[model samples]
Target: MKEKIIEALKRIEQEFEVKICFAVEAGSRAWGTSSPDSDYDVRFIYVHKTDWYLSIDQKRDVIELPINNQLDLNGWDLRKALQLFKKSNPSLMEWLHSSIVYFQAFSLDGKMRELEDQIFQPRASLFHYLNMAKGNYRNCLQTAAINSKRYLNVIRPILACMWIERHNRFPPNEVQPLIEALIMEGEVKRELLTLIERKVTRDDHGFEVDFPIIHDFIEKEIRHLEEYANSLRGPSRDFTATLNELFRQVLEEVWSQS
Candidate 1:
Protein backbone atom coordinates (compact mmCIF):
# COMPACT_ATOMS: atom_id res chain seq x y z
CA MET A 1 0.00 0.00 0.00
CA LYS A 2 2.77 2.42 0.95
CA GLU A 3 4.74 1.71 -2.23
CA LYS A 4 1.61 2.11 -4.35
CA ILE A 5 0.86 5.51 -2.86
CA ILE A 6 4.43 6.68 -3.36
CA GLU A 7 4.37 5.50 -6.97
CA ALA A 8 1.09 7.31 -7.56
CA LEU A 9 2.59 10.51 -6.18
CA LYS A 10 5.66 10.12 -8.38
CA ARG A 11 3.54 9.64 -11.49
CA ILE A 12 1.56 12.85 -10.81
CA GLU A 13 4.75 14.81 -10.17
CA GLN A 14 6.46 13.61 -13.33
CA GLU A 15 3.57 13.20 -15.79
CA PHE A 16 1.43 16.20 -14.83
CA GLU A 17 4.48 18.37 -14.02
CA VAL A 18 2.70 19.44 -10.89
CA LYS A 19 3.67 19.02 -7.29
CA ILE A 20 1.02 17.18 -5.35
CA CYS A 21 0.58 19.66 -2.54
CA PHE A 22 -1.78 17.43 -0.61
CA ALA A 23 -3.35 13.97 -0.74
CA VAL A 24 -5.81 12.02 1.43
CA GLU A 25 -8.35 9.23 1.54
CA ALA A 26 -11.68 10.96 0.78
CA GLY A 27 -14.51 8.42 0.87
CA SER A 28 -15.73 5.39 2.86
CA ARG A 29 -12.21 4.37 3.88
CA ALA A 30 -11.36 7.75 5.37
CA TRP A 31 -14.58 7.67 7.36
CA GLY A 32 -13.51 4.26 8.81
CA THR A 33 -15.81 1.67 7.19
CA SER A 34 -13.96 0.38 4.16
CA SER A 35 -14.16 -3.31 3.29
CA PRO A 36 -11.10 -5.57 2.89
CA ASP A 37 -11.30 -5.41 -0.90
CA SER A 38 -12.26 -1.71 -1.03
CA ASP A 39 -10.41 0.61 -3.38
CA TYR A 40 -8.50 3.67 -2.19
CA ASP A 41 -10.33 6.99 -2.68
CA VAL A 42 -7.21 9.16 -3.06
CA ARG A 43 -8.01 12.85 -3.48
CA PHE A 44 -5.33 15.48 -3.98
CA ILE A 45 -4.35 19.00 -5.16
CA TYR A 46 -1.57 19.98 -7.59
CA VAL A 47 0.31 23.10 -8.74
CA HIS A 48 1.27 23.58 -12.41
CA LYS A 49 3.53 25.91 -14.41
CA THR A 50 2.37 29.49 -15.10
CA ASP A 51 2.50 29.28 -18.91
CA TRP A 52 -0.15 26.58 -18.89
CA TYR A 53 -2.64 29.11 -17.53
CA LEU A 54 -1.70 31.89 -20.00
CA SER A 55 -3.75 30.38 -22.83
CA ILE A 56 -7.15 31.87 -23.72
CA ASP A 57 -8.96 28.60 -24.26
CA GLN A 58 -10.57 26.95 -21.21
CA LYS A 59 -8.53 23.99 -20.00
CA ARG A 60 -9.52 21.12 -17.78
CA ASP A 61 -9.92 22.78 -14.44
CA VAL A 62 -9.93 19.52 -12.51
CA ILE A 63 -7.99 16.30 -13.04
CA GLU A 64 -9.15 12.74 -12.41
CA LEU A 65 -6.00 10.63 -12.28
CA PRO A 66 -5.88 6.95 -13.16
CA ILE A 67 -5.95 4.29 -10.44
CA ASN A 68 -4.40 0.88 -9.77
CA ASN A 69 -5.75 -1.98 -7.71
CA GLN A 70 -4.67 -0.31 -4.47
CA LEU A 71 -5.08 3.38 -5.33
CA ASP A 72 -7.32 5.88 -7.12
CA LEU A 73 -6.06 9.47 -7.53
CA ASN A 74 -8.28 12.49 -8.26
CA GLY A 75 -7.93 16.25 -7.75
CA TRP A 76 -9.73 19.57 -8.16
CA ASP A 77 -8.41 22.23 -10.48
CA LEU A 78 -7.48 25.12 -8.18
CA ARG A 79 -9.07 27.64 -10.54
CA LYS A 80 -12.40 25.81 -10.74
CA ALA A 81 -12.25 25.53 -6.95
CA LEU A 82 -11.94 29.29 -6.32
CA GLN A 83 -14.74 29.98 -8.81
CA LEU A 84 -16.93 27.63 -6.78
CA PHE A 85 -15.74 29.32 -3.61
CA LYS A 86 -17.45 32.62 -4.44
CA LYS A 87 -20.69 30.73 -4.96
CA SER A 88 -20.15 28.95 -1.60
CA ASN A 89 -19.82 25.42 -3.00
CA PRO A 90 -20.09 23.01 -0.09
CA SER A 91 -17.82 20.30 -1.56
CA LEU A 92 -14.94 22.76 -1.93
CA MET A 93 -15.49 23.84 1.66
CA GLU A 94 -15.43 20.20 2.74
CA TRP A 95 -12.12 19.62 0.89
CA LEU A 96 -10.57 22.44 2.88
CA HIS A 97 -11.64 20.87 6.15
CA SER A 98 -11.38 17.17 5.24
CA SER A 99 -10.52 15.04 8.27
CA ILE A 100 -7.98 12.93 6.35
CA VAL A 101 -5.14 15.02 4.94
CA TYR A 102 -2.68 13.56 2.42
CA PHE A 103 -0.78 16.84 1.95
CA GLN A 104 -1.61 20.42 2.98
CA ALA A 105 -0.70 24.08 2.72
CA PHE A 106 -1.27 25.80 6.04
CA SER A 107 -2.21 29.01 4.25
CA LEU A 108 -3.83 28.09 0.90
CA ASP A 109 -7.04 26.24 1.71
CA GLY A 110 -7.42 28.23 4.92
CA LYS A 111 -7.08 31.52 3.06
CA MET A 112 -9.72 30.41 0.56
CA ARG A 113 -12.13 29.74 3.41
CA GLU A 114 -11.52 33.23 4.79
CA LEU A 115 -12.22 34.80 1.39
CA GLU A 116 -15.55 32.92 1.32
CA ASP A 117 -17.15 35.49 3.62
CA GLN A 118 -16.29 38.35 1.28
CA ILE A 119 -17.51 36.57 -1.86
CA PHE A 120 -20.43 34.66 -0.37
CA GLN A 121 -23.74 35.13 -2.21
CA PRO A 122 -26.75 33.66 -0.50
CA ARG A 123 -28.80 33.27 -3.68
CA ALA A 124 -26.13 31.21 -5.47
CA SER A 125 -25.63 28.90 -2.51
CA LEU A 126 -29.35 28.36 -2.02
CA PHE A 127 -29.76 27.35 -5.63
CA HIS A 128 -26.78 24.99 -5.41
CA TYR A 129 -28.05 23.03 -2.41
CA LEU A 130 -31.61 23.01 -3.62
CA ASN A 131 -30.53 21.60 -6.96
CA MET A 132 -28.39 18.96 -5.26
CA ALA A 133 -31.29 17.92 -3.01
CA LYS A 134 -33.63 17.65 -5.95
CA GLY A 135 -31.20 15.57 -8.01
CA ASN A 136 -30.39 13.21 -5.17
CA TYR A 137 -34.06 12.88 -4.25
CA ARG A 138 -34.93 12.03 -7.83
CA ASN A 139 -32.19 9.44 -8.29
CA CYS A 140 -32.32 7.76 -4.87
CA LEU A 141 -35.89 8.01 -3.67
CA GLN A 142 -37.61 5.81 -6.24
CA THR A 143 -39.40 3.80 -3.53
CA ALA A 144 -39.40 3.48 0.29
CA ALA A 145 -39.17 -0.28 0.38
CA ILE A 146 -35.72 -1.78 -0.39
CA ASN A 147 -34.22 1.67 -0.92
CA SER A 148 -31.61 1.70 1.83
CA LYS A 149 -29.50 4.77 1.04
CA ARG A 150 -32.53 7.03 0.54
CA TYR A 151 -32.26 8.53 4.01
CA LEU A 152 -28.67 9.72 3.55
CA ASN A 153 -29.50 11.10 0.11
CA VAL A 154 -32.35 13.15 1.59
CA ILE A 155 -30.67 13.88 4.94
CA ARG A 156 -27.49 15.34 3.43
CA PRO A 157 -29.29 17.92 1.32
CA ILE A 158 -31.94 18.73 3.88
CA LEU A 159 -29.18 19.30 6.42
CA ALA A 160 -27.48 21.62 3.94
CA CYS A 161 -30.73 23.55 3.56
CA MET A 162 -31.12 23.65 7.33
CA TRP A 163 -27.60 25.03 7.66
CA ILE A 164 -28.18 27.63 4.98
CA GLU A 165 -31.40 28.71 6.70
CA ARG A 166 -29.85 28.92 10.18
CA HIS A 167 -26.43 30.41 9.46
CA ASN A 168 -27.07 31.78 5.99
CA ARG A 169 -23.99 29.80 4.94
CA PHE A 170 -22.98 26.37 3.62
CA PRO A 171 -23.10 23.28 5.79
CA PRO A 172 -20.13 21.12 6.82
CA ASN A 173 -19.91 17.66 5.19
CA GLU A 174 -19.22 15.80 8.43
CA VAL A 175 -22.40 13.75 8.82
CA GLN A 176 -22.53 14.01 12.61
CA PRO A 177 -22.19 17.81 12.73
CA LEU A 178 -25.03 18.27 10.27
CA ILE A 179 -27.26 15.97 12.27
CA GLU A 180 -26.21 17.34 15.66
CA ALA A 181 -27.16 20.88 14.63
CA LEU A 182 -30.76 19.91 13.91
CA ILE A 183 -31.85 16.57 15.40
CA MET A 184 -32.16 16.51 19.21
CA GLU A 185 -34.39 13.54 20.00
CA GLY A 186 -32.72 10.49 21.59
CA GLU A 187 -34.37 7.71 19.58
CA VAL A 188 -34.06 9.48 16.26
CA LYS A 189 -30.46 10.34 17.00
CA ARG A 190 -29.74 6.73 17.88
CA GLU A 191 -31.15 5.62 14.56
CA LEU A 192 -28.77 7.87 12.66
CA LEU A 193 -25.83 6.83 14.78
CA THR A 194 -26.75 3.20 14.28
CA LEU A 195 -26.89 3.73 10.53
CA ILE A 196 -23.37 5.08 10.48
CA GLU A 197 -22.14 2.31 12.70
CA ARG A 198 -23.84 -0.34 10.64
CA LYS A 199 -22.18 0.97 7.50
CA VAL A 200 -18.88 0.75 9.30
CA THR A 201 -19.53 -2.83 10.42
CA ARG A 202 -21.13 -4.18 7.25
CA ASP A 203 -19.75 -4.95 3.82
CA ASP A 204 -20.35 -2.70 0.78
CA HIS A 205 -23.65 -4.14 -0.44
CA GLY A 206 -24.97 -0.93 1.20
CA PHE A 207 -26.64 -1.30 4.56
CA GLU A 208 -29.90 0.20 5.86
CA VAL A 209 -30.77 2.27 8.92
CA ASP A 210 -33.51 1.05 11.21
CA PHE A 211 -35.68 4.13 10.92
CA PRO A 212 -39.14 3.43 9.51
CA ILE A 213 -40.55 6.27 11.64
CA ILE A 214 -38.19 8.96 10.32
CA HIS A 215 -39.23 8.76 6.64
CA ASP A 216 -42.18 11.16 6.99
CA PHE A 217 -40.04 13.71 8.81
CA ILE A 218 -37.35 13.60 6.13
CA GLU A 219 -39.94 13.76 3.33
CA LYS A 220 -41.57 16.84 4.88
CA GLU A 221 -38.23 18.61 5.17
CA ILE A 222 -37.36 17.80 1.56
CA ARG A 223 -40.68 19.24 0.30
CA HIS A 224 -40.24 22.41 2.37
CA LEU A 225 -36.72 22.93 1.02
CA GLU A 226 -37.86 22.36 -2.56
CA GLU A 227 -40.66 24.91 -2.12
CA TYR A 228 -38.33 27.51 -0.58
CA ALA A 229 -35.77 26.96 -3.34
CA ASN A 230 -38.24 28.06 -6.02
CA SER A 231 -38.20 31.64 -4.72
CA LEU A 232 -34.40 32.26 -4.92
CA ARG A 233 -33.06 34.53 -7.68
CA GLY A 234 -29.79 33.75 -9.52
CA PRO A 235 -26.51 35.48 -8.71
CA SER A 236 -25.86 38.99 -10.04
CA ARG A 237 -23.14 39.68 -12.62
CA ASP A 238 -21.00 41.17 -9.84
CA PHE A 239 -20.69 37.75 -8.21
CA THR A 240 -19.28 36.14 -11.38
CA ALA A 241 -16.64 38.85 -11.73
CA THR A 242 -15.55 38.37 -8.14
CA LEU A 243 -15.32 34.61 -8.63
CA ASN A 244 -13.22 35.05 -11.78
CA GLU A 245 -10.76 37.32 -10.01
CA LEU A 246 -10.39 34.91 -7.14
CA PHE A 247 -9.72 32.06 -9.56
CA ARG A 248 -7.02 34.06 -11.33
CA GLN A 249 -5.36 34.79 -8.03
CA VAL A 250 -5.29 31.10 -7.15
CA LEU A 251 -3.84 30.18 -10.56
CA GLU A 252 -1.07 32.77 -10.24
CA GLU A 253 -0.23 31.74 -6.69
CA VAL A 254 0.01 28.07 -7.59
CA TRP A 255 2.08 28.72 -10.70
CA SER A 256 4.56 31.02 -8.96
CA GLN A 257 5.19 28.62 -6.11
CA SER A 258 5.44 25.62 -8.41
Candidate 2:
Protein backbone atom coordinates (compact mmCIF):
# COMPACT_ATOMS: atom_id res chain seq x y z
CA MET A 1 0.00 0.00 0.00
CA LYS A 2 2.87 2.37 0.76
CA GLU A 3 4.40 1.54 -2.58
CA LYS A 4 1.06 2.12 -4.28
CA ILE A 5 0.75 5.49 -2.52
CA ILE A 6 4.24 6.47 -3.66
CA GLU A 7 3.42 5.48 -7.21
CA ALA A 8 0.25 7.56 -7.07
CA LEU A 9 2.19 10.59 -5.78
CA LYS A 10 4.85 10.27 -8.47
CA ARG A 11 2.14 10.04 -11.12
CA ILE A 12 0.51 13.15 -9.74
CA GLU A 13 3.80 15.01 -10.00
CA GLN A 14 4.28 13.84 -13.57
CA GLU A 15 0.74 14.68 -14.66
CA PHE A 16 0.69 18.12 -13.06
CA GLU A 17 4.30 19.04 -13.95
CA VAL A 18 5.08 19.99 -10.37
CA LYS A 19 7.36 18.77 -7.59
CA ILE A 20 5.92 17.30 -4.38
CA CYS A 21 7.77 18.78 -1.42
CA PHE A 22 6.22 16.34 1.03
CA ALA A 23 3.33 13.91 1.39
CA VAL A 24 1.82 12.13 4.37
CA GLU A 25 -1.02 9.90 5.53
CA ALA A 26 -3.94 11.76 7.03
CA GLY A 27 -7.22 10.88 8.86
CA SER A 28 -7.63 7.74 10.98
CA ARG A 29 -4.66 5.87 9.56
CA ALA A 30 -2.32 8.62 10.67
CA TRP A 31 -4.20 8.95 13.95
CA GLY A 32 -3.39 5.33 14.86
CA THR A 33 -7.03 4.27 15.15
CA SER A 34 -8.02 3.14 11.67
CA SER A 35 -10.27 0.17 10.97
CA PRO A 36 -9.01 -2.65 8.76
CA ASP A 37 -10.93 -1.30 5.77
CA SER A 38 -9.90 2.36 6.05
CA ASP A 39 -8.97 4.31 2.94
CA TYR A 40 -5.57 5.86 2.42
CA ASP A 41 -6.01 9.61 2.74
CA VAL A 42 -2.90 10.88 0.98
CA ARG A 43 -2.30 14.62 1.15
CA PHE A 44 0.67 16.50 -0.25
CA ILE A 45 2.13 19.93 -0.88
CA TYR A 46 3.70 20.71 -4.24
CA VAL A 47 5.55 23.52 -6.03
CA HIS A 48 5.39 24.45 -9.69
CA LYS A 49 8.39 25.55 -11.72
CA THR A 50 9.47 29.19 -11.23
CA ASP A 51 7.59 30.31 -14.34
CA TRP A 52 4.20 29.34 -12.88
CA TYR A 53 4.52 32.03 -10.21
CA LEU A 54 5.64 34.61 -12.75
CA SER A 55 2.30 34.52 -14.52
CA ILE A 56 -0.11 37.43 -13.92
CA ASP A 57 -3.21 35.36 -14.63
CA GLN A 58 -4.93 33.88 -11.58
CA LYS A 59 -4.69 30.11 -11.23
CA ARG A 60 -6.09 27.30 -9.13
CA ASP A 61 -4.02 26.54 -6.03
CA VAL A 62 -5.28 23.05 -5.24
CA ILE A 63 -5.12 19.59 -6.83
CA GLU A 64 -7.91 17.05 -6.33
CA LEU A 65 -8.01 13.55 -7.75
CA PRO A 66 -10.93 11.17 -7.88
CA ILE A 67 -11.39 9.10 -4.75
CA ASN A 68 -11.87 5.35 -5.00
CA ASN A 69 -12.14 2.69 -2.29
CA GLN A 70 -8.40 2.08 -2.05
CA LEU A 71 -6.93 5.58 -2.19
CA ASP A 72 -7.92 9.21 -1.65
CA LEU A 73 -5.31 11.61 -3.03
CA ASN A 74 -5.18 15.43 -2.99
CA GLY A 75 -2.66 18.24 -2.60
CA TRP A 76 -2.12 21.96 -2.19
CA ASP A 77 0.09 24.35 -4.16
CA LEU A 78 3.12 25.59 -2.23
CA ARG A 79 1.93 29.18 -2.21
CA LYS A 80 -1.50 28.17 -0.96
CA ALA A 81 0.08 25.95 1.71
CA LEU A 82 2.26 28.76 2.98
CA GLN A 83 -0.72 31.09 3.01
CA LEU A 84 -2.60 28.63 5.22
CA PHE A 85 0.48 28.17 7.39
CA LYS A 86 0.45 31.90 8.05
CA LYS A 87 -3.12 31.61 9.30
CA SER A 88 -2.33 28.57 11.53
CA ASN A 89 -4.75 26.29 9.71
CA PRO A 90 -4.87 23.19 11.97
CA SER A 91 -5.43 20.83 9.05
CA LEU A 92 -2.17 21.91 7.44
CA MET A 93 -0.41 21.62 10.77
CA GLU A 94 -1.77 18.09 11.12
CA TRP A 95 -0.33 17.24 7.69
CA LEU A 96 3.05 18.49 8.86
CA HIS A 97 3.09 16.20 11.90
CA SER A 98 1.52 13.10 10.35
CA SER A 99 3.53 9.97 11.17
CA ILE A 100 3.24 8.22 7.78
CA VAL A 101 5.39 9.95 5.19
CA TYR A 102 5.09 8.73 1.61
CA PHE A 103 7.53 11.21 0.03
CA GLN A 104 9.77 14.16 0.80
CA ALA A 105 11.80 15.76 -2.02
CA PHE A 106 13.27 18.88 -0.45
CA SER A 107 13.83 20.92 2.73
CA LEU A 108 10.30 22.33 2.75
CA ASP A 109 9.08 19.85 5.37
CA GLY A 110 11.90 20.52 7.81
CA LYS A 111 11.77 24.24 7.12
CA MET A 112 8.05 24.27 7.85
CA ARG A 113 8.57 22.38 11.12
CA GLU A 114 11.21 24.85 12.18
CA LEU A 115 8.82 27.73 11.63
CA GLU A 116 5.91 26.02 13.40
CA ASP A 117 6.31 27.82 16.69
CA GLN A 118 6.88 31.18 15.04
CA ILE A 119 4.02 30.82 12.61
CA PHE A 120 1.47 28.96 14.78
CA GLN A 121 -1.15 31.08 16.47
CA PRO A 122 -2.36 29.28 19.58
CA ARG A 123 -5.60 31.21 19.90
CA ALA A 124 -6.74 30.38 16.38
CA SER A 125 -5.65 26.75 16.58
CA LEU A 126 -7.42 26.29 19.88
CA PHE A 127 -10.64 27.62 18.44
CA HIS A 128 -10.32 25.44 15.35
CA TYR A 129 -10.10 22.19 17.32
CA LEU A 130 -12.62 23.41 19.87
CA ASN A 131 -15.16 24.06 17.13
CA MET A 132 -14.51 20.65 15.64
CA ALA A 133 -15.16 19.06 19.01
CA LYS A 134 -18.33 21.06 19.56
CA GLY A 135 -19.76 20.52 16.10
CA ASN A 136 -19.09 16.79 15.99
CA TYR A 137 -20.56 16.30 19.46
CA ARG A 138 -23.75 18.14 18.56
CA ASN A 139 -24.33 16.54 15.17
CA CYS A 140 -22.96 13.03 15.51
CA LEU A 141 -22.21 11.82 19.04
CA GLN A 142 -25.49 12.74 20.66
CA THR A 143 -27.14 9.53 19.51
CA ALA A 144 -27.52 6.46 21.74
CA ALA A 145 -25.52 4.29 19.37
CA ILE A 146 -22.59 6.42 18.27
CA ASN A 147 -20.90 6.15 14.93
CA SER A 148 -17.45 5.03 16.07
CA LYS A 149 -15.80 7.30 13.52
CA ARG A 150 -17.81 10.28 14.70
CA TYR A 151 -16.81 9.49 18.28
CA LEU A 152 -13.23 9.94 17.16
CA ASN A 153 -14.10 13.19 15.43
CA VAL A 154 -15.37 14.60 18.71
CA ILE A 155 -12.83 13.17 21.15
CA ARG A 156 -9.71 13.93 19.12
CA PRO A 157 -10.55 17.61 19.05
CA ILE A 158 -11.44 17.66 22.74
CA LEU A 159 -8.09 16.06 23.52
CA ALA A 160 -6.37 18.52 21.20
CA CYS A 161 -7.99 21.40 23.02
CA MET A 162 -6.80 19.95 26.31
CA TRP A 163 -3.27 19.76 24.91
CA ILE A 164 -3.34 23.40 23.84
CA GLU A 165 -4.64 24.48 27.22
CA ARG A 166 -1.91 22.58 29.01
CA HIS A 167 0.98 23.47 26.69
CA ASN A 168 -0.11 26.82 25.31
CA ARG A 169 0.44 25.48 21.79
CA PHE A 170 -1.02 23.10 19.23
CA PRO A 171 -1.00 19.42 20.17
CA PRO A 172 0.70 16.72 18.17
CA ASN A 173 -1.47 15.46 15.27
CA GLU A 174 -1.42 11.79 16.27
CA VAL A 175 -4.18 10.53 18.58
CA GLN A 176 -2.21 8.08 20.68
CA PRO A 177 0.06 10.71 22.17
CA LEU A 178 -2.84 12.99 22.97
CA ILE A 179 -4.64 10.19 24.81
CA GLU A 180 -1.62 8.93 26.66
CA ALA A 181 -0.35 12.33 27.68
CA LEU A 182 -3.64 13.95 28.64
CA ILE A 183 -6.33 11.35 29.44
CA MET A 184 -5.36 9.92 32.80
CA GLU A 185 -6.10 6.53 34.34
CA GLY A 186 -9.84 6.50 34.85
CA GLU A 187 -13.11 5.15 33.47
CA VAL A 188 -12.87 7.64 30.61
CA LYS A 189 -9.45 6.38 29.57
CA ARG A 190 -10.46 2.73 29.93
CA GLU A 191 -13.60 3.23 27.86
CA LEU A 192 -11.71 4.96 25.03
CA LEU A 193 -9.11 2.23 24.89
CA THR A 194 -11.89 -0.31 24.53
CA LEU A 195 -13.39 1.71 21.70
CA ILE A 196 -10.05 1.94 19.94
CA GLU A 197 -9.60 -1.80 20.15
CA ARG A 198 -13.03 -2.35 18.64
CA LYS A 199 -12.45 0.26 15.94
CA VAL A 200 -9.21 -1.28 14.76
CA THR A 201 -10.83 -4.64 14.06
CA ARG A 202 -14.35 -3.59 13.04
CA ASP A 203 -15.72 -2.90 9.60
CA ASP A 204 -16.11 0.61 8.17
CA HIS A 205 -19.56 1.04 9.69
CA GLY A 206 -18.81 -0.13 13.20
CA PHE A 207 -20.92 1.36 15.96
CA GLU A 208 -20.17 1.72 19.68
CA VAL A 209 -22.66 1.57 22.48
CA ASP A 210 -22.76 5.07 24.01
CA PHE A 211 -20.69 5.45 27.15
CA PRO A 212 -21.46 8.22 29.60
CA ILE A 213 -17.85 8.46 30.77
CA ILE A 214 -16.88 9.64 27.29
CA HIS A 215 -19.89 11.92 27.04
CA ASP A 216 -19.38 13.60 30.41
CA PHE A 217 -15.70 14.09 29.72
CA ILE A 218 -16.36 15.76 26.39
CA GLU A 219 -18.94 18.15 27.80
CA LYS A 220 -16.80 19.20 30.74
CA GLU A 221 -13.73 19.56 28.54
CA ILE A 222 -15.56 21.70 25.98
CA ARG A 223 -16.86 24.14 28.58
CA HIS A 224 -13.40 24.42 30.12
CA LEU A 225 -11.70 24.93 26.73
CA GLU A 226 -14.05 27.77 25.85
CA GLU A 227 -13.05 29.75 28.90
CA TYR A 228 -9.42 28.70 28.58
CA ALA A 229 -9.17 29.73 24.91
CA ASN A 230 -10.50 33.17 25.80
CA SER A 231 -7.76 33.50 28.40
CA LEU A 232 -5.01 32.94 25.82
CA ARG A 233 -3.08 35.98 24.56
CA GLY A 234 -3.08 37.50 21.04
CA PRO A 235 -2.02 36.04 17.71
CA SER A 236 1.16 34.07 17.16
CA ARG A 237 4.43 35.70 16.24
CA ASP A 238 5.23 36.41 12.55
CA PHE A 239 8.16 35.46 10.34
CA THR A 240 7.09 36.61 6.90
CA ALA A 241 10.60 37.46 5.76
CA THR A 242 11.85 34.03 6.76
CA LEU A 243 9.02 32.28 4.92
CA ASN A 244 9.65 34.41 1.80
CA GLU A 245 13.29 33.35 1.78
CA LEU A 246 12.23 29.69 2.08
CA PHE A 247 9.82 30.09 -0.85
CA ARG A 248 12.61 31.46 -3.02
CA GLN A 249 15.08 28.79 -1.93
CA VAL A 250 12.68 25.93 -2.80
CA LEU A 251 11.84 27.32 -6.24
CA GLU A 252 15.48 27.95 -7.12
CA GLU A 253 16.59 24.48 -6.05
CA VAL A 254 13.68 22.47 -7.48
CA TRP A 255 13.62 24.29 -10.84
CA SER A 256 17.40 24.51 -11.28
CA GLN A 257 17.87 20.83 -10.42
CA SER A 258 15.10 19.79 -12.79
Please tell me which predicted candidate would have the highest lDDT against the true structure.
2
For each candidate, how many residue pairs have backbone atoms clashing (under 3 Å)?
A: 3, 0
- Per-residue lDDT of 153-239 in model 1, one digit per residue for the tens? 556666768777778765665676777778787777777666555555553255555546556666677678767767766565456
Off by over 4 Å in 2: 141-145, 203-210
User: lDDT of all the models against the reference?
Assistant: 0.65, 0.84
> What is the lDDT for 205 in model 1?
55
**Model 2 agreement with the true structure over 1-258: per-residue lDDT tens digits:** 888888888888899999999999887899888887888999999999888999999999999999876699989999899888888899999999898998988889998899887778888899999998899888874565655677878889888888877887778877777888998867788777666767787743555544677878888989999998898887645767777888999898778888
Clashing pairs in 2: none
What value of lDDT does candidate 2 attain over all alpha carbons? 0.84
* Cα RMSD for candidates in order: 3.6, 2.0
Report how far off residue 252 is in candidate 2 (Å).
0.7
Error of 1 at 73 (Å): 1.8
